[model samples]
Target: MRVSAKSDYALRALIEMTNRTAERAVSAEELGRAQEVPSGFLQAILADLRRAGIVRSQRGQSGGWRLATEPTAVSVADVIRAVDGPLVSVYDMRPESVRYQASAEVLQHVWIAARVALREVFEEVTLAQLASGDLPDAVTARTAHEDAWQSH
Candidate 1:
């Protein structure tokens, strides 16, 4: 369930774009500078986001990048998936696609539950929420638990 640096950078770029005037395009350099991400890496992330239909790029002097859709319509899961694929996987395969022997039957349920729990948080959270600093109560409550903040 670890998030990659690419996903983190993409989300940061999106948040930067979200803060801009709706019609304004943000250059990769601006986004990278604002988020402290490498400009070259940010470009690659932007390309991935564009391919995922989460962002659009413009050319010419006024050209830059903007979200393809409203921030509210783009979930954290979407951003992560755009760059990193599935949120959870067993040996790189989706939980449902894996076959388990009788002795390992319980492991399947464990994997499925893990994926579901991860989705419950990520799918419910949108880029707008992150940009606005308005997280859902469910997310806040879950993270508020003492154990949630402590290292395992």
Candidate 2:
């Protein structure tokens, strides 16, 4: 599955927030700058996260953004879905919702399986783990194989 720029930027911003002082909100300009994402694009992504209830914004001179919930409570998958919608979609439809005719019917199963595989990793990882530089064992194991790094 392809990861959208929105999703990547959102995750980067969220992880950066996790590393900062929770008592104070971080401004959009700061987040965008630190994450190396465009200010306008990051603003839209932050707004999406706010709408998804993953983040909360403040106003006034101290106005900025903060996580709506604990970092441990927010999964990578949650961030992706909040910004980019479904983990896997075929023509903007859920994998299970898509139908293939004839021999191509098996393609449906392939999509479903692909989604499952993505969930196993994305759902298993949380913002806290990422911020602390401590990935889950399952994730680390996958990365331990040199073949996993090679581009086909």
Candidate 3:
């Protein structure tokens, strides 16, 4: 399972915004520059986030984007969902929804299990936790191991 570019860009932009005052909106240009993401793609991601209620936009001469809720209240999973569709998808379908023959029946459970493991990390981590460089104990433990840093 891997995060899509949209989700990655959204999270990076959110982290950038996390450092600013909630009342102070950041422009797409600024966010794009800060995160090195394409401004056009970032704008589209931010619009989706706004529609999802994850971020709010102010339209006018003095307008920009801001988080709808506190940084700590926003979870990585939430941002991912707001930008991408689902956490994990198998062949463009949910693992539970797919049917298989008796030999492959157990595969559904395997995919679901994969999703569960992803949630354990993403859902447990909040934006504030990431910005502070103090992840939850579970996440920290996962990173503490040298193997965790290695690309499989």
lDDT of each: 0.91, 0.94, 0.90
Best by TM-score: 2
User: Per-residue alpha-carbon lDDT of model 1 for 1-152, expressed as tens digits?
Assistant: 68899999998889888878486888999999999999999999999999999999999999999899989999999999999999988889998899989999899899999989988999999989999989999999998878988987
lDDT of 3 at 4: 90
Residue-level lDDT of model 3, residues 1-152, one tens digit each, is 88799999999999898878564788999999999999999999999999889889998877899889888899999999888878888888888899999999999999999999999999999889878888999988988889988997
Top lDDT prediction, candidate number? 2
Model 3 gets an lDDT of 0.90
Q: Write the per-residue lDDT of candidate 2 for residues 87-146, one digit (tens) a residue.
A: 999999998898878889999999999999999999999999999999999999999999
TM-score of each: 0.95, 0.98, 0.96
lDDT at 38 for candidate 2?
A: 94
Q: In model 1, where do residues sit more than 4 Å from their true spots? A: none
- Looking at candidate 1, the ten consecutive residues that score lowest on lDDT are 15-24
Show the colliding residue pairs in model 2: none
